[model samples]
Target: MRIEKHPILTFERGKEIYFIFDGKRIKAFEGETIAAALHADGIIKYNTSPKLHRPRGLFCAVGHCSSCLMTVNGVPNTRICVTRAKEGMIVHSQNPRGDLND
Candidate 1:
């Protein structure tokens, strides 16, 4: 479910790779960012705010805002928008306290 036939960017589907999110199996392109792939899969809620715990998603789509932050492979405070998706990567939703290692 990609914009394969987009007008601007040439559609060059990359190699498929498997990754896990909250114990769920998900497939992503080799060179795409984790956020992009997740968004493509209809995953909008990335993390919650630290204090208010409000839901946050892709705001800037350029890593400017911390709204798209999530946990990746046990690393906390990872900016999914800028982070590229990799094979066998593990991504998880951040906790309400803004903690991922927990």
Candidate 2:
């Protein structure tokens, strides 16, 4: 769910770009952030905590926090909140031990 009728910001998206999230195909915008795209697709849990395995989602919406960490194209610990979405980008949630979630 998003603010479709923002008084100041336009709701129109950029050029369409396809990507993989958890082995599923998802369409996002060219210049959108990974977290934004995931959020748009109703993916709120980006990672799980180490010991407790608690679900984590976008908190700061910036690169300053680890709440949005995930795996991008085989790389671990990627901050999706600040990383710009790209075409064919593979994104997956990162487990607490720094591995991609199955």
Candidate 3:
């Protein structure tokens, strides 16, 4: 969920845009991070751990961690938490090796 109104901070949401996530269309705002859009759209599962195959989601919100890694426009291991959401972008959940169709 997005905080539209905040006491300390302000949210300057841009024009609404659409993107493809795992073949499903998702709504997002311009300049917002991909992870933020996904979370706002109720998508919490970003990827799975490479070894144990456990579920993983956004952890650091920064680009320093792999928890938010996923394939964006066929690019694997992309840090979605810091990646800006764009119109018509293709995103897919990573497999055990952090890749889709790899």
- Number of the top-ranking candidate, with TM-score as the measure: 3
Worst 10 residues of 1 by lDDT: 93-102
Residue by residue across 1-102, what tens digits does model 2's lDDT show?
556788788877789998999898887888889888888889887778878899879999869987887889888888889998899999888766566436
Task: Give Cα-based local distance difference scores for all models.
Answer: 0.81, 0.83, 0.90
How high is the lDDT of residue 35 in model 1?
82
Candidate 2 C-alpha error for residue 6, in Å: 3.0
Query: What's the candidate order when arranged by decreasing TM-score?
Result: 3, 1, 2
TM-score of each: 0.86, 0.85, 0.91
If both were scored by lDDT, which would come out higher, candidate 1 or candidate 2?
2
State the lDDT of candidate 1 residue by residue for 57-95, as single tens digits: 888989898888778898877898989888888888877
Cα error, candidate 2, residue 42 (Å): 1.1
Q: Which of 2 and 3 is the better model by lDDT?
A: 3
Sorted by lDDT, highest first, which candidate order results?
Answer: 3, 2, 1
User: What's the distance in Å from true for residue 19, model 1?
Assistant: 1.1
Clashing pairs in 3: none
